[model samples]
Target chain A: MTIRTTLSAGLAAMSLTATLGASTALADPVTVGLITTLSGGGAGLGVDIRDGFQLALSMSGSDAIHLVVEDDAQRPEQAVQIADRMIQSERAQILTGIVWSNLAMAVVPSATAQDVIYVSPNAGPSQLAGAGCTPNYFNAAYQNDTMHEASGAYANVLGYENTFIMAPNYPAGIDALTGFKRYFEGSLAGELFTQLGQTDFAAEIAQIRASGADSIFIFEPGGMGISFMRQYAQSGIDLPIISAAFSFSQDVLPAVGDSALGVINTAEWSPDMDNAANQAFVAGFQEAYGRLPSVYAAQAFDSANLILSALAAADINDLPAFRTAMRAADFDSVRGAFRFGNNQHPIQNYYAREVVSVDGVLTNRMVGTAFEDHQDVYATDCAME
Target chain B: MTAALFLEQVLNGLQLGLMLFLMSAGLTLVFGVMGLINLAHGSLYMIGAFFCAAAAAASGNFWLGLIAGTAAAAAAGALIEVTVLRRLYDRDHLDQVLATFALILVLSELTKIGFGPFPLFLDVPPILSGTVNLGIAHYPLYRLALIGFGLAVALGLWLLIARTRLGIRIRAGENDREMIAALGVNIRALYTLVFALGAGLAGLAGALVGAVQSVQVGMGEPVLILAFVVIVIGGIGSIKGAMVGALMVGVIDTMGRFLLPRLFGHFMEQSQAAGIGAALASMLIYVLMAAVLVIRPKGLFPAHA
Candidate 1:
């Protein structure tokens, strides 16, 4: 990933020098401008996306494809700055990668406005799935809230009547909360919205203890989820925690330990998934990276696969045909199957999963398929004709 | 709301406040004495969490992990103070900020390299894991323990500052540096020890928090920012200030997040209420800090001698 980033950085640096200090600038490669939070706490996902994309490129025999990767450093406005340079200056036709919904929102509109194709690897903002959906914007991932909504349905089926929801105060949080409520026929005893990236959830958990919330549905991802889950388990409530997919993914499974054992999560990807593409992707990813692939990797792989198949079927150099072919490609997804929605987001299945023992080792696996091609609630607002 | 529900929320808020105090007291002390704004203090907190998780996992004992995690932070802090920060005492805040920011990158990456990018979990001891019925509501025993633990640290800090030679030296350092150095205090060692002590406090907070949370790279930063806010409101370098600031911030934050949306709901749509309430709740601490700054400039409990 660093190699690709450095190579992109090298290209960008060269182009920058040429733009400022030359007339002999001739060798400008296909610059794929990438923006994501590559620093701060969320850097975990950012690094994974960066490395996953680079690995795909490497496996496909390309690095000088000129990826002008820039770190938002987890800052939203900074992402805009990087996007601007990538478009006007780097002459990038395609923009790829964003880890945060806020950052994605910042970069995607700008990319689409310039008629540039933006391939989103991480954040699938509900706005993009609905009224804000655009032909120029393509999500290589599931909408943010679909996975949690799936969890909610499973929990509802399991007979959890009172569920409490907590999430960071951000657009993605709202999406996840909405999703949970959609399928979770239970009464929300209370919903706690916190600052994005908040470390402590003790106060909220304590409040929940008294709320008589039979089940807790939380959507905190990354380090925050780890803290909340461990604490929740430590709280000795014994309430089943139906979680959004990101909360207990590969990135955090080990961190949360045995406490994460019964954590039923909902997501589109899991290593133990019963599918040929997924099996292949998991094995290959582990072999290549020396660790199991998280959902982010699967999402990136599918995105690249879609891109490859689209480029192959249509005139690779023709932008309009490429976009049309991609929209119609119905590419082989690792998540069994999915199709692009009219809004350029995916109408895909979400799964109900639990961390179960695989050969005496614990890891999350799919228990049941929950929501089928679940559309975002905000899709109604997405005014794309 | 029922009395139990309200009582539970208050306890929850205090637990949150104590956790904040654990981080902010050290931060405020460091700021008061050194005038260095460390953006990477969170990294040290993360270190403690990672260490505690690893130690507890390796030892199968939560207490040992807690101690080891605290020690690990102290050692790391001492090392950083000696190797990196010692050179920066003469530099400006921008330089200090940049250097510490870079340290965050190095430390987070280093943690990733060491621990592998998977999140690590620490288990609460069985005895501490159960919940207690507080007359009206069931609350986690561990959270109550955290509040107790935080109080112990606060009292311990107060006693140390008021009754010990080292504490007096630290107080002296906060007031005058050259005079203290002239008085034959090993100012260098004092700084290292103080930094390490502060780091240890941050680490203890990390380890304590780790039992409830996932331990991963860059886990300490959000708490670190809030810690800064705590100290800023409490007055830099004052332990009492940190306590008051932490409690105020935690209670306000907790209540605002819980009640503000409902309050706003009375005047607006549900979604709009939630959005406005959540945003306001998160920003409320900062708003409070700004207000205090406007009135007092030096914060509520200024550390000035």
Candidate 2:
């Protein structure tokens, strides 16, 4: 995989320089560096993002953008190193496709400080969304807390008075619980900070059973979520669960299987959203990849289109004009009515989605609107010069 | 905590301990008999899970998948023992570590190539799906089944070591490898058999636990770390120590996670207590290991003594 990525990147760079030599002024080729987790535990998310981004580029049939993809393997140091190499050696103007927040935190600030355009397909850490927000940074995805906040709001709508909340002990986990509490006007029956990557949840389940909570709000992403959901189902507690879509995303739904059926999750987009852009995206992704695209993929697809939109409106050589074009977000987002807030993070609708079997495949369907036209709270803190 | 909740946590601890025993038993045995440190033991566990999940998905029967998983792991164990580990047996600890570590990487990548990047689904069988009333607390039947299976395996292992000719030979081999080989025993074949047995046990644990957890490429590494701690606390190369240490580690870890936060909740805010408690709970097992080592340098039940 590494070899193929390097070879493809080399080919793209060669073609880019060849095109530059041929034409002096019109349609300058822009280089995009995609640094994501392509190996280890978190590979599924990165694979989806890469495939989604590639699919969008292909569907547009535009050769003006040359993408150089590298695997960070979910390591913060590796992401930082890749960002440096892409910036200094590869001369990649736009950097994108980091999956985890820790990696994003490591790479984004420095990348943007170097005057490189940093477009986030996912992993919108609160630091970047607030006081640290830079003019060179644009997040095509919702801020990290948006889905958790949406879950909190949806829980209120469902009339849950007491909810047991649990998250892994990490920066993002803290953010998740804090995000939920910001919008949730209810009593917390129990709050748990489980070990990150700790698979067993028997003790936690026992506590939940004894806590007498009306509902559960969990923020365990990836394998942790898969383990928790399966064990929780077998525990037979019968408490309704509310969570962000990270746990119920299409990348993991098959592994989670029937355990996630009918569970309510909140996200910016679902495969079943009733929009022309979303329908086309879902259909196009299925045709291209032979599977359903997760929220990560939707974000990456939007990120690619956002770049494409900017490229069409302005030249990359003019940094100021290109930055303005990106801020305008003049593209049809997979999630309808997408636009950038003051922080350059998306201000969009958050929807409640339910896991349902579609033709024997486990996927999410749109249930209801959790929050309409929701802008992140951190936008006010962002003072982009 | 209520008495029922405490009892449930105890049961959870026992279940976790037994799974660790299954993993550590094999690891300790290989270390005792051959003096070979096999870091790729976790790879065998991962292989077992992948095989089990794939077989279960293909055959549509959990039992068949379990059997296939165990057998596949045993075969892979034997193959590796013959091809790669045979060379490292005569090398020093560092060489063995390096070789086995490489084996882990190779095995993980191969599994990924075979199974793809996504985690596989492996559910509990219908017979063991729901919760069972345990007089005080309702516990998941599948977990109870796992505890029972662990106990059964432990009993079977004890009986094999104490009562069988192979067991006698194994004990003798552990005492003196040269003497056993001089006494007309095929030591190479015996080594292969023991390695396969250990691999099979690890694989069994992997298949059992994979039903509840995510069955992915690196699932075994975390458990492998705990298993190492179990063996260290129990005494290296001692199955008896593995059992006692596993139980102690399991119970203390679970209870710490269950009680520590609440203990702090008396003086501090709930969320602060939870964060501090969880941080402490994660380190509880290691602290226990260190304490055990200070008190009993040879572990609770050293094989040689």
Say which candidate scores most in lDDT: 2
A247-269, model 2: which lDDT tens digit per residue? 99999999998989999999999
lDDT of 2 by residue, B1-305 (tens): 79999999999999999999999999999999989899999988988988999999999999988998899889999999999999988789999999999998888888988899889999999999999998988999999999999999999999998899999988988999999999999999999999999999999999999999999878888999999999999999998999999899889989999999999999999989989999999999999999998999988888787
The local lDDT score (0 to 100) that residue A52 gets in candidate 1 is: 70
Q: What level of docking quality does candidate 2 show?
A: high
lDDT (10s digit) by residue, model 1, range B134-234: 77667788889999999999999999988999889988999999999999999999999988998999999999988887677777877888898998888
The parts of candidate 2 lying over 4 Å away from their true place are: A1-28
Candidate 1 Cα deviation (angstroms), residue B234: 2.8
lDDT for model 1, on a 0 to 1 scale? 0.80
Alpha-carbon deviation at A22 in model 2, angstroms: 9.7
TM-score of each: 0.86, 0.95
- Candidate 2 chain A weakest ten by summed lDDT: A21-30
